[model samples]
Every structure is written in structure tokens, then in C-alpha cells.
Target: MLIEPLLEIRDVSKTFPQPRTLLEVLARQPKRTLHALRGVSLMLRPGETLGIVGESGCGKSTLGRCLAGLHTPEGGEILWRRQPLSDIRRADRSRRIQMVFQDPYSSLNPRMTIAQMLDEVLFVHAPSMSSAERRDRTDSLLQMVGLSPGLKNRLPHAFSGGQRQRISIARALALEPEVLVADEPVSALDVSVQAQIINLLESLREKLGISIIFIAHDLNVVRHISHRVAVMYLGQIVETAATETLFGNPQHPYTQALLSAIPVPDPDIRSLQVGVQGELPDPLSPPPGCGFSTRCPFVMDKCEKPIPEFFDSGGEHHVRCIRAHSSTFSVPA
Candidate 1:
């Protein structure tokens, strides 16, 4: 039997207007906008983690927002198990897609206590839950996320970044969502705290079988958590493969550059490596062809034209690069 993927996005697109000057904007025709995401297609299986890794301004966050319905795509389809998500009933939708944002300290309201926050979710998603049941579940959630019921009365200011993030996870899990969309969830925390949260998420996935779309700028952080990884660059996925395949034998130049940047922990090896070159290309009216062509070391003349279509890199592995499908370029030693 074919394993039916839980989430599917097809040709999703989002663009934002770029106005250089007030006079220019008013006098001339409407100018080009930042194409935050362009014709992006992807699939997520149930109870699996698909890591989205990219540098800043590469549209990783925008795609996360689109997947969680925080920002509707201007084009394309978002489907959950073959059914269009846009057509999902509101009540079901609430219990289906949940988001855990970065900066938990800011995501919470200063006025609401932990109990109140969890209660609100219960009220919206499970109103049938009695006050006693809601209170009971609140405690359960706190414990589940490694927080304490004793701290339930405290405000956001009382907890450290890690603790606050735990609360955020508790709240996201409150409705027992089928899919958790996390956007830079650990980027704002200390390294130790980041590890704890990552561990917690992995444990929860095992225990609850909830699917996760984990988005982060650091591929190293996602290395342990993701089953499959998709590398994004300037509004498109340059390569996608299993975690082992991606890290060990990357196909796309962008993916290779990203891997090369991962700092070697050993001091002796640190001095030997190089990094990706050039500043990120302007997203507004992105270049005619492969966006990374401007910086790619092995870019061919074909790269200056329209990007080659996604090419197969064997079973379940895909890469979008002329070099990827061409017989000419060999993997660097």
C-alpha cells in the first residue's frame, strides 16, 4: 500500500511589494515585489519530521507561515491527506494545524497566567472539557512539557527562555494537533536549552505520533531531529533528501555550501574549511535563472537562463540543478 502523505503543497507563491521611494511608487507603474516563495511543492508524511533549512531571507519562515495557514498562499494548494485544507471545517482546522513560534517569551501575553493560556486553548478546541477537566489537563500538559503545576500561576517574566518555550509547546499540544509547525523554535534559547527542547519534541513525536514541520536556519540543529530534510534558497527548494543522504552526499550546490558551513567542532579541522560566497541575491525580481547561479562556483551558462526543472537523484531524492542531472560535473573529492 502506498504511504499517503499528510501534507501537500503545490506551486504555492507569495510576493510582497517593494517601494523604494514614495514619489517613485506614486508616479510610476507598480514595481516588482519580493517573491518570498515561488512555485514551491512539497510533501510531509504523518508522524514524520521534515526539516526546512536555509539562510536568512530565503523564505523558510514564509513557507512555514503558509503551511500553518498564518499566511494564505496567493496560488497553489495545501492539502491534508488528499483533502484540501482550505475546505477543512473551522473547528477541525483548529485541532489539526498548530504552531510553536520562536521567542516564546514574546508569544505569550504578560497578563495571562499559564493556567489561563492553556484554558483558552481548551475552551476553543475542547469546550466540552469541564473546568476541572481543563485544569487537570493543564497540569498534565505542564508535566508533559517538563514544567511544573506550581509555576502555573506565574507570568511569562518569571521563566527563563527554555521554560517559556516549554509553555509554548504545552499550549501548542493542548489541542492535540495532528501536525506541529515550528518556526525557529529553539533559535532564541541557549544551546543547552535548545537541546532540551529538541529532545522534548522528539519524545513527543514518538509518544503522540504527531507530524512536525521543523524550520530553522541552522541545518546542524535539525540534523538529529529530522527524518528528511529540504534545503531552501531564495524561495525554492534546491534539494531534498533523507537526512543521511543529504549530509553525506549532497547533490545541489546550495546544499553543498550549506553543509560546508557547519563548523567543525575540532579546532584542528576548523581552519581547513571554506564557506558559501556572496551576499544573498535580491528577492525582489529575483534573477532570470537559478538564484544561486550568481554565487555558485560551478555555475554553467545554462544556469544564467531559467532554472532546470527538478531532477531525480535516485529513489525519493530530488535536486534542482543543471549539474545535478548533467553527466559533466562529478562530485568533488
Candidate 2:
């Protein structure tokens, strides 16, 4: 029997309106909405890391914010164990789903010490806890993220980028959340630091058994931790598959282009950056057809037509391309 997913996102869409400039406002221009997410759907299995990879402005961050309830969707549903996420009580939701933001410095309060921040979180989430228990728990959280309890009284400014991020991770886990939405948790750190944070997250996931939605533009980073990967383009998921299956044999044009760009170790077999022509279309007025059609190397006449639905490549892999059924559209060697 198949186990139900911890989170079910079905056709969730989020749009943000552009604030009118003085000239536009004076001219009485029509308000335009940026389609941050359009009919996005995916299943986040319990205790599995689902990596979301995409170009900048492709709605990866927006999707994370939507999952964390920072931005409410304009359409569709987000289900937590088959129950509507919106209906869950605020405090209950906070404990169940937590988000570790991209920038640790910005996410943490400079005025509050590390211990104070952790204590505040515990107080809010577990108000019935005794002061002694809270302190114990705070120290445990810091240690769990590989930080010293002595630094608990230190400000965020005193910590390195990686240390600060660990604190951010610790804060997110303070409530013992079942799901963690990590949005580029290590992107701002040094290369060495990125590896450290990634290992910490992997260890935490294994130990805590918490499902993670890891969003990052770095394919290598996503590949290291994700059980499955979803590729997004222009506010929609163009392809999704098991980690190895996607890297070994990507079907979608956008996904293929992305994977091809990864550098290889062999000098004779250097990575080829597939010249995917054109740039991402403006979300304010997206193309009528597939979002990646303009950049797709295998473009066809029908590709310009609106895609009403996605085509499944196999039971495990899914692709939004109309040519998903054709083998000729495979990425060049």
C-alpha cells in the first residue's frame, strides 16, 4: 500500500501585482500582476527531501513562501495530511511546518541574543514548559545544530555566515516541526561552509525524520540531499523525477539544459552548455504555450499553443512538455 504524502499541493497559484510608479499612477495605467506561481502541483512525501531547482525568478522562492504561509495562493489547495492547510489553527500550523529562510542575518533579530531567540520561540510554541525545561531544550537545539551552548548569549553578528545559518536551522527546529521548508539555507555562505550546512541538514533529516523541501539554484547541492527533484520554469513545474533518474535521463527541455550545464571532472569530456535560446518570458504576460517553448531546442508548431495539461513520462517521472511522449526530443549527447 502507498503511504499518503505529508503535504499535497494541487494546482496552487500565486500572483503579485506590480506597485504603480508615480508616472504610471498619474497616467492611470492598468495594474499588472506578476504570475509568481501558476497551477503548481507536487507531493512531498513524509521524511523525504524534495528539491526544487530553477532559474532566478522562476518562482522557487515564491513556492516556498506559499508553503510556509508567508504568501497565500490565489488558487488551488495545500493539504496537510488530506486536511486543508488554511483551516489549520495558526499555532498548530507553526509547530507542524517551519521555514528556514535564505538569509540568516536578516531572519534573526540582531537585538536578541541566540539564547533569547531560541527561548522566545520555545515560549511561544510551548508556553506550558517550565523555565528549566526551556533552557535545557534551547541548549539541546544549539548543540544539535553543532553550535556551542556558550555562544547562546552572543549576538548573530558575532557568528560566521555558516554559524548564523546553523542557528537559523536550530530556531526552525525548536518547535520540532514535521516539515522544514529550507529556502537556499546555504547559498550565501562560502563554498566550504555550504558543504558543512548541507551535511548538517542531511544529518538532521536522518535523525529527526522530518520531510524537507530544499530550494536552490545549485543543481549539485540539490542532488546531494534530495530524494526527488522538481524543475520549475516560469511559475510552473516543467519536470519532476527521482534524483538519479532526473540526472541520468532528463526528459524536459528545460531540465535537460540545466543538467547539461553542470561541469564534469574529465578534461576530454567537458560539460556542454546547451544553448537554450531566449530568456524566461515576463510573468506579467507569459507566453500562451509551454513556458519553456521559446528556449526549447526542439520547438514545434504546436508548442506555441496553450498546454492544457502535462504529459506523464513514466509512473515516477512527470513532464509538462507536449513532446514528452516523443523520444526524438531527448537532450543531445
The candidate that wins on lDDT is 2
What TM-score does structure 2 among the candidates reach? 0.95
What digit string (tens of lDDT, one per residue) describes model 1 on residues 197-252? 99999999999999999999878888989999999999998888999888777878
Candidate 1: which pairs clash?
A: none
Q: Candidate 1 — what's its lDDT?
A: 0.88
Local distance difference test, each candidate: 0.88, 0.90
Quote the positional error of residue 311 for candidate 1 in Å: 1.0
Q: Give the TM-scores of the predictions, in the order they appear.
A: 0.94, 0.95
**lDDT of candidate 2 over 276-299, digit per residue (tens):** 787778999998888888888878
User: How many backbone overlaps does candidate 2 show?
Assistant: 0
